[model samples]
Target chain A: MSQKKSSEPTPLYFVGIDGGGTKCRAELYDTTGNLLGAGVAGAANIARNGDVARQSILDSVKAAIEHANLPPETLASTLACGGFAGANLPSASNALKQWQHPFHSFYFTSDLHTALYGAHDGANGAVLVIGTGSCAAALKDGELTQFGGHGFLLGDKGSGAWLGKQAVVHTLEAIDAIQPKGQLAEAVCDHYQAHSATALVDKLNQANPGVFGELCPIILELAHHAEPTAQALVKEGCEYLSAIARKAIQQSNGALVLAGGVAHALQPLLDSDVQAKLTSSTHGPEWGAIMLYQHGAFNQGANA
Target chain B: MSQKKSSEPTPLYFVGIDGGGTKCRAELYDTTGNLLGAGVAGAANIARNGDVARQSILDSVKAAIEHANLPPETLASTLACGGFAGANLPSASNALKQWQHPFHSFYFTSDLHTALYGAHDGANGAVLVIGTGSCAAALKDGELTQFGGHGFLLGDKGSGAWLGKQAVVHTLEAIDAIQPKGQLAEAVCDHYQAHSATALVDKLNQANPGVFGELCPIILELAHHAEPTAQALVKEGCEYLSAIARKAIQQSNGALVLAGGVAHALQPLLDSDVQAKLTSSTHGPEWGAIMLYQHGAFNQGANA
Candidate 1:
């Protein structure tokens, strides 16, 4: 068979970036199987930290281009897509416009949008992101229709941060001897390196929420070991996340796709309840970016 | 009228102190109604912060004696009573025993015991302390029973700290645009100098639980203006406190006396729903100490 040359220039490469509160990552690829480059940088969520997020996005994009050995001038000609933290808010959108990155076309959406697309391979479904913060998004026919992300104080529910907070609470209770003796008390003390409840308070008071949220993995480890307090925390988190999924399904009439770091950690908890309603995605946000580019979603003035 | 003179020297003096998580206060009185001295210091809750609490109690006691100009040599003949945090804990008992004051006789009890005695004039009743921490205690025919007081994280349902925490959570929800708009967001933001949800994250991350708990007064102040979020917080606190009261009543079968800074602040919130179940106390721990000394509870260790 003879190879046939297409008449039009191959669709220009498209990049999709998931700019989160803690980190920004960019994936570059063409329509074919060529994986150009991947870039990582500091946080890029304007809703989380304004100017820092914008700088992170710019830095990440530049790094990806350099890593791919692509001409810097050609960066402006490539279609770029990003799902950022504050893009859903007008104030954040205005801040993003101040960035002087050159691109042939660009599309910006909330982080939920890209995660949803990534989870469902551009199809219609729901995706729950549970990490330092938590949020759920439902897509119906390629359009986001419902969401449940706001952070810990509001509706984080089953997020790692939430579990970590619960662990701290339980540990403190044990230290006070207010609640009956439980394994969680010892586990928390061990995790924080505190000899007594008073010391634990000092440690917790000094630590940041992000640092505290990091302790969530220890909670999971304890849960696996059958600690009652740890089990209760995970159970509560799973229930909250499941409720979010149920609400999303009710709103969008779609299946559920779990994403983010905490997603796989909580799979065992979710599987026992919503196994039939869930599926894993074959392609992630990178493919979702290409799909958006092909549909002309990344036009010069599309976002405007 | 001539007074009968006895050869036995009258008891030189008696003192009673209420040392709590937020403050340490002591009252000194001679055999007559003459007030000798009064002293105040910072928090003295050994369970919450051991070294700070111990130092506060010692400082307050020293200040009282210094203010009264009592001869240091005569102090050994004085009778003293103290109600302190963690007095109920055996581990704390040993630590407390290390404190040696220049007094002939000394007695110690949990703050709750003194508060109950103060509120009920040494009679049997229940008193709920809803300060930075929440704990409920009931006295039934001289027997003390307690519940709650797990600290800010584990329990403390109706405490100032608990209400403050709830207010923060609601404010965060409002900032995230997850919950309905309310005055709580404005009040909290105004107090913390935070303009957005992300700013709140930083504030909460860096602030200590005590600092966070201080915001309770703000919430209480706003509730007076009929703000729904503020009102809700107070209402919830009242209900939780009442629930503890109800439990104490069921366990001890006694009248109720509510004490503590939070109880006074949220008094308006405790409407008939709470008042119908329990009676408020006219006095607090200070009076309780005097009554204990007068009744010779101090002379008999078992009675104390």
Candidate 2:
């Protein structure tokens, strides 16, 4: 066997991808399960805009390969797994599966699945993601359940986008004199430099959730400073997030992880009991995607 | 003298238009101010989409000419005055002014200006547009002021679009187990027949405010039947509307005319004190446009 080098088994490479409405991320790993490199790209929401997502996925994978110092053609020999926002829908899942992908093998699942898996290191637990969007999920006896992540328009009550929308709405009210010019209102006006309501409207009339999401940090800062309006909004949003956490933990009876950009700031504000159940995530979504691919679940239905 | 009749001054024809987020309406009148015909077209909020509004304005004028059994050439000789929703913005006003219009002369003013003028029959009064979008305007001492009409995303708290968004948000929460599936929730589910949370999201993912606005009727009906969720939302919206009404009345010291598709439905639901100031519009916005033009108010700034 040592004399015949051609008979040796080829090394395996894995690319794990986690794509959401705001960004797409990828990590490269070697056969020993050691992380090689990671990369990030723009929005990859398959259901919202499949074409953009496909391109983002491609770009993210290519960037990951470059980061790993691997040959560009290595993608042809790599196994890829992706967990994407909006892929929870059967149609979106099938649409993803039908792609003429370049990878040796490709697997797809919901972003929540990967997030939850990463939260517990492939164990049964719960996760609440509180970033540009918000949602909760739990894994119980290998079964998964999700709730409260309906995107910016419908739900996402505790999300950054939601907070941003509330900030803008309050600012507009202040401008119109419908509401008092509270601290939060004044801050928003100053932040945007919008001297007039009409100019403010012109600036934000067609703004997307991402633009609004950018205001989340300001909202959090204001809330921390105890601005009345910001405090009220933060309180309302945290209440909903706490409810979600309680529900997830109750369903799974396991430790919960609060994840996402705004999660840390909110973690301390959640219901005390809910906060008690919170645990640090063991790995990231990319690792979770790799684990999901190896577990044989990704080959099944949308839930799987 | 009869042979030289052509030398006499020709009677002027006027066309007045009222354009909003929902529709563009036009009325033709003789020099004697006698109604000739009326026509309606699609959306014409100039600030939102100038090109679309321009086309709508043109089509509405053409339709009115046809309704009057006049030749198309009549438009070239007609003095046109338009009261458009977004015309209050300086940029939108300039854009409208730059249009290569067919009318002998075209004058523009804010929709609220015309609405106020029409409400008081060219006198000083207040008007609250409660249709697809909501805004209240008051005229006092020949000066007009507007508030609470910040379109769907920013304000429009008591608007049809606002009510619809609330209904959907409540429904999503109910679907997510964050809230109990009350009567409004059940009705929403039945209305869309969305058996799953994902299915419901699919149905409403890309919906515009107008689509949500259509749900105003259902919301109103449910509130009337004392459905807890709908009633709460309606009550909240009506409180805002009442506040707007009181503000408008207090500013102008004149009767307030509630105008819009959802106005009638929300009228009785408003606070009784505010309701006391309510009066039917003396005339429609098209007539208001005409009145503004005749009064030489349309030739001035955005408010004019």
Task: Calculate DockQ per candidate and list them.
Answer: 0.07, 0.44
Please give the TM-score that candidate 2 achieves against the real structure. 0.90
Judged by whole-model lDDT over C-alpha atoms, candidate 1 comes out at 0.68
Query: Residue B116 CA error for candidate 2 (Å)?
Result: 1.6
The reply for model 1, stretches above 4 Å from the true place, is A1-156, A159-304, B1-12, B31-33, B66-79, B100-106, B196-198, B206-209, B271-273, B277-283, B290-304
lDDT of each: 0.68, 0.83
Give the CA lDDT, 0 to 100, for residue B37 in model 2: 89
Write model 1 residue lDDT over A169-271, tens digit each, in one string: 6666555444566776776677778756545654564343465677778888988999887888899778767766766665667778777778889877873
Q: Write the per-residue lDDT of candidate 2 for residues B1-304, one digit (tens) a residue.
A: 0111335344368888999888999999998989998889998988888998989999999999899999999986787787898877777778877787777667778888888898898776788888888989899977888878877777888899899888888888887787999888887778778867888887787766677887888889999999999999999888888877778888898888888788888888889888888788788888888888767676443211
Q: Once model 2 is optimally superposed onto the true structure by TM-score, how far is the C-alpha of residue B267 displaced, in angstroms?
A: 1.4
lDDT of 2 by residue, A174-194 (tens): 876778988887777777788
What interface root-mean-square deviation (Å) does model 1 yield?
A: 7.1
Where in model 2 is the C-alpha error above 4 Å? Answer: A1-12, A47-52, A89-105, A299-304, B1-12, B48-52, B89-105, B299-304
The TM-scores of all predictions, comma-separated, are 0.56, 0.90
In candidate 1 the C-alpha lDDT for residue B35 amounts to 73
